[model samples]
Target: MSVATGNPVFETVGGDASAATVTPTGRTTAGSLADLAAQVVTNTTDAGTAKANAVSALNTANSAAAQATEALSQASKAITSSSANIAGGYAALDGSGNANVPGNMAVGASNSGARSFSIGHTGLKDWIRFQFYTGTGVAANPDFVFIGMNGTGNTDGTCALQGTAFQPLSSNTMTLGSSNNAWSGITSQTAVDVISDLNDKNIIGTLGNATYADVTAKLRVVWASISGVVYTLKSGQSGRQHIGVIAQYVAAAFKAEGLDAADFGVWCSTPKKQIVTKAVDGQKIMSIEPVYETDGKTQETQETIRYAELLSLGLFCEKLERADLEARVAALESKSTSSTAA
Candidate 1:
């Protein structure tokens, strides 16, 4: 039955309210108390199912949160242990369980088996400095061996040996296994043998008939008196012998070897400019400042001749003297023959 707006439609006529009599719309709707009770039951079932699903989801979230907390606690413990180990000078385990010691790094060997420590650079220029203490009575002991490599793979470098109350030994001499050899003790026979070997390769000219004594005298002309006033250590030390030829003399003797005398003179003069006057133990003292070549532009790198070159020059000097003596002897012999014939 169609009902107009604001019109009340009474369903029950005389007895109880029947579902058929109480049609709320054009289509039949629930009108009895039993039907209303069944709808209430269905709503309650849906609500219960929703509440169960929410509890299940909450349980899963709580489980995940607990796992995260346990992981964070373990990480904190590891960090604390690592910090303690570092403070106590113990090696700490890295993420890969490898022991890493602080301040000490090892390469090419295990930490326990490492025999040497090395620092290297791949660039064209690199240098290392060994700084010593400057205070009085503090032993400024620094022992280092610098090995230089070239295409032929030979070790070449300078060694400075210093002692108490003495000057440093700054010469290029190779020491092998506790055997210390002095360059001054080089025998005349050894020098001759080296000259012979070089002559075979056309590296040096013939020495003719010059004696070792004659060459030694020539070399002596280039030697200057080293006073204690200049070197300080030579003041009271008598019978002291200085090895190594003067750079200027070497340059003069080996003009054909492309050595410039001006270059050698400049290098030799550098030491004079390096002198500093200072008071030590209530007495005025002068000392030459040490020069370190960081940029590689120093006189040592440019002007200093190698020991082999010095040896070659000594042999060549002998040859020149011998040739002059031969010419003089021949002239005298010729003059005597001419006088007798006249």
Candidate 2:
């Protein structure tokens, strides 16, 4: 285009010169078209880059979510395992990175570590067991009762008794007698010598025969050190020894109330005064009754986990099954996809 100065020498378009030289119609510029094409390409590239960035962000977020789910699954399994250990009737390693049952089995002197044991019913034997706490001079207490109720008199038929039984001693060492009897003097006893003495002496009356029907029996050991630590042996039994002189009261109550084995649940807790009160109410046994009848503080030294604890554990396992953590993760992934598509 040329200035409207009537200059014929200046032409605007189509190789034609006119007086209206300012006209801009019917024209094309190589430089301006090239610039426009460049702008369009730049816009397309920027949009593609933005989409790629969004995808990268989404991938990172999805990875984080997966990690979180995995962590939760691991934690869930850990909790379930711990609960199972507790329900199994042996003090488990505490969550504090320590393996030990609490209460009387608590960390003892010279015993830098805790023991772990399990209990199960074999035939007519119904019993609960705990890890044997080992230490020096823990055996033989003047006030402790160490009697083994040998229903079958084998390693399996052994049960802890709260009552005293006469044990025949060949010499200074006692031997498991062929017949059932009681011994009167066992003050401080450790786990090692307790069961051996009972087995060899055969002091328990039920030796060579089954005492209770369909029961769980465990090796028994009850001890009180001069220092006031009471160690009880956990072995198989009908769990009848769970009742001391009060056995009749417990049995009668269960029968009168029509309470069955299902009604009474076993659990171990910290021992204390009025221990029996801790037993489930109306479940039959009102509280914890020692396998042995003893005075004051010794009663406080014994603790048991309840059968209810096991019942609760079963419920927890059921929850884990329903959660189906794997399924949940899959569902979360699908949802993320749908959202990103939108």
Candidate 3:
């Protein structure tokens, strides 16, 4: 029965709203304040599940990233320490697990008139140091050194040496050249016969390494310095290119799940690029930000979630520490729910 405005003491209800009924179980109601509590609990439960799922996904990504990073590291180490042959040469290695070169290589010569010598190691690396010298046994400049791969089947490797011209060798050993900027086009080579031939002619050039490993380690350093990952970004364009690539992968996953492009509120733009939220106008849904804020705009929130994830990735990618990342994700998920409740 329904209660009227004039009825204050009448009770004929057999439903959950009955106050006179005494039962072993708790009373239930179709419309009560407890429903709001239940809704809040449900939303919280959903967020919790989403958070757990996100953390799981992040863990997967991080695990993959860690595997990739480890693989790269192993590759680098192998390049430095592999006894495995490349183009008929052994892997150069040093005492500290670093790669090195062979011994008995000479650097400078006491001859006059544009003396150029080539210094290199077998396998593992391609560039060499070219020392210039003059007559009268005087070094015009010990700071000028040339680096490049020796061309095959030619005198001094097709005369591939750069000519900046310098003085003669003072001692019989090589010295540091200019510390300014190094020359490029060093190319790539991995032939033992060619490198050994260079060494036999006193063109191998003497280095400071006491052992073959030290020599190879030094050569590896030069190689990385000459060739490493670099980038340039356009004006107003954040360095989101890398993230954009990753996000594209994320987007494909999102679409595969059949998520609506509108109504549910999804905003994924390259950082620094203008963000446009998607919305619906009656029956017409456009994939652009509404011109009018009062025209019922989508509620948006910029979170540090990605940042936390990134930091987590950076911290655990190279190493194997999942506990830390899990803790951080948990804290973030807690904060997100707490804020929603507030």
- Best by TM-score, which number? 1
Error of 2 at 231 (Å): 51
Ten-residue stretch with the least lDDT total in model 2: 218-227
Error (Å) of candidate 3 at residue 332 is: 99
Predicted candidate 3, C-alpha RMSD: 43.4
Q: C-alpha displacement of 59 in model 3, angstroms?
A: 6.3
Say which candidate scores most in lDDT: 1
- List lDDT for all candidates, in order: 0.48, 0.43, 0.44
* lDDT: worst 10-residue window of model 3: 176-185
* Candidate 1 segments exceeding 4 Å error: 1-48, 65-69, 72-76, 81-101, 106-334, 337-342
TM-score each candidate.
0.29, 0.21, 0.17
Q: What local lDDT score does residue 18 receive in model 2, on the 0 to 100 scale?
A: 27
The RMSD of every model to the true structure, in order and in angstroms, is: 18.5, 34.1, 43.4
Candidate 1 per-residue lDDT, tens place, 1-342, comes to: 433443234444445544423444554553654565676799999999989999999998999999999998897666455364564456777789955666644465532222345444444233444333344664545433233332121334333323232223653353322212114333343443232354456322233334445534444343222111222224345656555545555555434444343532322233212456676656556655545466645533224444564444445655656777899999999999999999
lDDT of 2 by residue, 80-190 (tens): 444544544555665687565444543334322333343444454534433333435555543334333445535745545443444554555754421122242355565
